[model samples]
Target chain A: MSSCKFINTPALLLDLEIVQRNARLMLDRCQKLGVQLRPHMKTHKTLECADIMTGGSRRCIVVSTLAEASFYADRGYDDILYAYPLPFDKVERCAQLSERLSLFHVLLDNSLALQQLKKRPLSHGKIWHTAGVELTGIYAHCGNTYGCKGEEQIKAVAQQTTAITLQFMEKLKAIGIQGPKSSIGSTPSCSHPVPEMAMLSEVHPGNYVFYDVQQSLIGSCKLEDVAVRVLTRVIGHYPHRNQLLVDCGWTALSLDGGGRLPTGYAIIEGHPELKLTSMTQEHGRVEPISGELDFSQFPLGSVLTFIPHHACATAAMHPVYYVHSKGKIVDTWKPTRGW
Target chain B: MSSCKFINTPALLLDLEIVQRNARLMLDRCQKLGVQLRPHMKTHKTLECADIMTGGSRRCIVVSTLAEASFYADRGYDDILYAYPLPFDKVERCAQLSERLSLFHVLLDNSLALQQLKKRPLSHGKIWHTAGVELTGIYAHCGNTYGCKGEEQIKAVAQQTTAITLQFMEKLKAIGIQGPKSSIGSTPSCSHPVPEMAMLSEVHPGNYVFYDVQQSLIGSCKLEDVAVRVLTRVIGHYPHRNQLLVDCGWTALSLDGGGRLPTGYAIIEGHPELKLTSMTQEHGRVEPISGELDFSQFPLGSVLTFIPHHACATAAMHPVYYVHSKGKIVDTWKPTRGW
Candidate 1:
């Protein structure tokens, strides 16, 4: 059986034990808060993890792309929410998908989208009716939460998102639409305990599954709680420059950084003194935080794992993940990517 | 016949005519400089585009990952170079592939990798012999050239990279290996008319096939020469915040910005006043340069195209490309992705 040492470098590695623990933590937190957990599958876009996150019941999940919605919908996952604002170009596919699935929801924050949806021709060549296309909810993402400075700023953004969502719900109600749930959330706001909107039926938080350096800096999860990492090999050492090059680059880890984190790109798992300073398409330049790096410790071919700045963007780079449990390869999961 | 309006949103659209023109320009430039053009396939990893770039010869190509090497080799593209430094764990696979292909090369920059390659055991249970594994060339990326300010700095980086590659070639010769080509290049140095290293056998310039906003900012290519773009739709308009949200986000475009470009994220095609200031997973927040946006001009559901900051990272996000010629999709090409 393939194990950590046998797997290729620059592969996505997941600690299944840690992932399960994270899932349980988030699940229990939502249960305690008396809100339904509709975990976002955009981070780990695989059915196996989605099944575990929803406790083996593929009831509710959020997707970032229409390709994901179609992938899950094909596999008997009916309660799927395309969390991004609805694209008018995909109205036909959305309507057809809505007809097949029990609940295929599309989120929109503008009135023009509502008018377009209202005017779309159904299969019978008439204007859209409530019975023709079923929407599970109308949700708004408070993406600005990522820019929040602290608890006060996060709470303010959350309240603002909640108010906007309620206003959209009222707009829906005025247009003879009823009973659709209202949802609003982001990783920071969902992780915080205060300012929970009671009117919202569900929360869709994707990054809590594998909190990265960015989330940790935002106080959402600790560094050690990060479950996913890119397994790379040190290929070259430039001791004169106090730098080393790794096999992981922007193609493996992603170019999502310069956040509140001290490290520019990613954090070296157990080496605070080391920093991934820069990257090319296929080579990452790592350097010592201070004077010089001892190249002998990390000889060429030695493995070094990195905790990425943004888990969602980093995870999207890999096609398959090497799932491990207690330092052994347990399984391999392939995520459905692309639109 | 599929046109721009009929295709799905967040789709990768490639203008075949533009791509061909870009390819011909680079190829002709390399020929005039008396240097071989080994186009790097990392940007557009499809055999179709590779054929066009190589003039249907499939002779020499640079790949960032083993996956690309294998994909091209399987399709009979024998002269493949794994441009990234060899990963320790993938050494065995590389050796096996070397035996099967006409020419498969691995790059190295440090002595440790050379020692590892020297010590690897062959199929006969003996130390690796030159006959056991064949190398195409020794290559060094003047990746630091991207940080260079102008012609002098770029030329300096080019000279440094050429020196390092020649030094590595000398080391290879000292170990009783001889007659392997030495190469060095990056887009900046390759695009510049000066600093042409006559000693280098070839140059691998990948991003030149589809120049990006970053490349244009670097003065590698004109803005109009950019061949790839992401087709998206305006999804929301927050007139109060002077913000407009597009369906294209970091997932579709990429977070590869903060270059010398005036716009931080991307350049919206035909809209100079707008800047894509921020992005979520599947939502890009666009805003005007100064005043509030005229919401009527960019109504929700209207389409807006964006030329990404980095073409390679942006292309990697899409699985397939809609190849358009004269406003119609003439073909579709799927890129092989994964490591």
Candidate 2:
């Protein structure tokens, strides 16, 4: 902290070491399993994290928004997949990206979207192959993995998703479609990858880059592996209400988990006794889980770090992430926002 | 829509006429009440909306964040009140602002905050005059008005808050403090203001510029007064699941109001029968509140307008708001985000 300048409260802090470790482990796991790791950029949309997650390849990334795709493509990254279903209004933008980039992909779950794509033809010798729709990949998000409890349940869901996806791919092959990739995603599934998943073409998981309390609870990562935190300071101590009001609120941490966590909205880092009971626009009310809150232990000016319930949701609330390592602020990463 | 170019989907659309009407009504109300309407910028942190709310006067405004204070201050706005309890981390910044601006106010609810403020002496001769902590005004938020169900409840809460605030001000005068000023705010209380509120020096009510479903439900304003909406397009039709996927998600509209509305997270404009049931990263699952959803009626690629649950929360999610009037694109307003 001595090396770092004055940091504004309610700031998003990213631990570089934890992030790098998370990224390296995921990349190594994917490489050993013989599956392409096209990491999703929805969680930490910053380029620094993307570079670490991609192992500096800067290719084969999945983005939830066109803004991210354009942002990455503008900075020498290619082979971007706008993983969302084809937004009809953005068809022209998609066509432009497909023409400009070496391999930009758009997805369609129905024939109407295919027709919408067909309405606009791509130049540069690109054609809508495979029955007027390029069967680039079959993407399935195993979102149900979020409901899992432990390693056994996570593995079970992962295996089930893999089996179902493989069966779908077999059906595609039976219909004489070949060479299209098959990818299934969700941080919980990818973190504890099943042996059967190795047969799939790729796996996309974004939240592992900055795992939060939600993922830790779902067996995706340990609590220590979660890299990001909202650094807030106590602003008020109300003994009558048995609460300590903090500067961090939904504006900083977001309301993603619906305050369902045992620790409420988020886990107060290193203080398992504290629970973030509720938040307004710019103020979070924190109270103890069981016993009385000793106000002296948490002086008004003292800082409290909160590990968020969902990293992706929390990260979206921040404009810039302060990267720190060895108790020193190293860098700042600005994430591209909006569609 | 014909006058505009291909507008982006999942876009925040601000009805310019409605905004102007809302602003004018609030301004007239405050003028008639004989109190200064110092609008809070937390709802729409944009220069355009600020100007409209202030009747083109950038002076006399309240903000929820320091970033907003700096943003407005940089653009020649004066008489700013950072209406948050002084955080220890921001004392120096507050001092600097006080020195730079003609009038910059910071609040304190505790003695420690006053000590922190005293430490940061402003370069300008701005003194901490009143017993070591300046009583700029007695500011209280009638947040309880949010729980009200109709105008009767709204007015009752407003009157009670006004009575309490006036009593506090009377106590201050009795203690020999003469000219500090008094103010209480919140959209609900300020909208249906009590006559006693006229005795106050100023009133700060934001969110009227773009009232949302929550405020309407709270009887602050009618649903027709909501001037902002998220413009999304139906992308997928899942008859088997009885759902239609829209391109808007929590990333666009935010997960506020806890999806407690009968229409779920947001009200589908002109389609009260439809409900925005749930959302993922980049998709919203739309299902009817009851009965089978007619698939053909909402064909893929058709645009859908969603009146948000909370305008402040939804407006914060957008990078830029598309302002429209008379079915034509009039202007765009980019809001300042993050603290």
Candidate 3:
């Protein structure tokens, strides 16, 4: 059989060893800090990977979608925080899963979403009311570099949260809903978290898994902390035009521009100046502004390393991670869900 | 049972009826043009969708990767085109698959790719070589918006064809290979193609499937002919700030910046001045120029339409199509491959 046939080009291949090391590193870091680590499963959709990360804790998880919550819940993951704003249309699923699972939390940032959730009339005898209405949380995305840029902007989220909570309460009372949890998280803002503002429950930050290009640019993490890098092959060169093409395209990587990160296809590791500058569907174009390095070293089929813009977003684009220990494949992990 | 669950809030959804209509429309268009239609399967990876698009003909398909090639080929599609540049590392797969399938055409813009394809010694016998190489076609991507522009660039591609052919023969001889086919396509350069220059047998243009922001920018198709659009809901409003956040995000639509197009996000049908201006992971920020129109008319939960930049690229982002028939979902069609 042809080797590497299973590993298709334009497919995301993660280094599992790096991933495991990354996960364990975070777990240990959190253990030292004495903070409850609720690793976001959005970075690795595989149930197996989650088990490894949590060490079979069935511990709390931060999910980007209710579907993720459902997937993990089916796999017996009981405590989960659906960290995105509750889509008003999806409140029923939230209420239903909340009843079945030990704990399921939904987030709402705006009055309209809370109003929609309120529209789901809670029957007095429903099982959902018993397990916990208080478990439902609200997340206010504050100080996102792509949108709100500064500390001044972070304050805007606080102001907005206060206003939103008041309106949220009014709708809850109208629908006769009881106490719910309050929570907030934005990695950029959480570094200087207003814990009092997210006073009701836990904080969920995903990017701390593998800080990337946008994180480094936003000062959320240093360049050294980046754990994930896409291994790509250089295919063509036109020195006179100052360009080279790499095999990693959006399909192999992802299309997330990461809000306000330095805009480029990807950050070239080892060679700082050579960024994956532009791309089409199947090719990445790299342009270096400084001295002309010997691209011939990469030649027509040399592999290069890359740091993605958003680790969570980029991870969602790939199918499997090739777990490597010191650059040789040891194990492979597959994501459980992607659609 | 629970309603169909969308994994993520901002994920792409296909209205099945609209998708069917889209397939029918494209099929009819190609039939009228007297050109054999090969729908780029990259847009929709589902087997069900591919069956409808191919109209029972899976002999020739345009794929973006070997994963897709192998995927469809396993499902009985024999003729395939790995349309992107065939990297040196992948030539063996091409040669191996040629032994099984009737044909597999690969695109090549530079001589380096050909050299790499030649570098691999064929693992198959002479019969495989003659049949496979004869069926294999080369494509020139001399029409990138950033690439050599206008007639001069087009002529450069034509002039380079002689050298390309001579180099191809020399490389084939050097590597003991023969019979590779030559082809050229790039909508910008091949729309009114100079066929005699390169001895091209067939033209492959996937973007001609559904013209979008990029195609429109490049003057390929008019805005009215665009077949696909993302239907999003106005989920939030900072009315005083003149910004409305919609449900479509980089996840639902895509992170394509409309590359060299007049419009950034998808085009808003009736509102010519309105742009889907900015996007985050789950929110599309729409901005209305002062005194032009009040976008609050959309309010919360109102649906709006958007045309993507590159139809094939944007289509790859979503798993299903919202198939509409005169503004209502009549059916749901699931793509064959995806999460």
TM-score top scorer:
2
Off by over 4 Å in 3: A1-37, A52-55, A109-138, A145-182, A189-200, A239-242, A258-263, A336-339, B1-40, B45-55, B107-138, B145-182, B188-200, B258-263, B292-296, B328-339
Q: Among all windows of ten consecutive residues in candidate 2 chain B, which has the lowest summed lDDT?
A: B124-133
lDDT of candidate 3 over A257-333, digit per residue (tens) = 73223437677777767767766666788877466756666676666777788776677666676555555556666
State the lDDT of candidate 1 residue by residue for B282-333, as single tens digits.
8888888778789999977888888888899899888888899999988999
RMSD to native for every prediction? 3.6, 1.6, 6.1
| Candidate 1: segments with Cα more than 4 A from true spot | A121-138, A148-180, A195-199, B121-138, B148-178, B193-196
DockQ of the two-chain complex in candidate 3: 0.31
C-alpha displacement of B218 in model 2, angstroms?
0.8
Which window of ten consecutive residues has the lowest lDDT sum in model 2 chain A?
A126-135
DockQ of each: 0.68, 0.81, 0.31
For residues A37-143, write the lDDT of model 1, one tens digit per residue: 88899998998888888888888888888888888888778777777666888888777876777666776555666666777645534333233245556666787
Model 1 earns a TM-score of: 0.90
Docking band of candidate 3:
acceptable
Clash total of candidate 3: 20
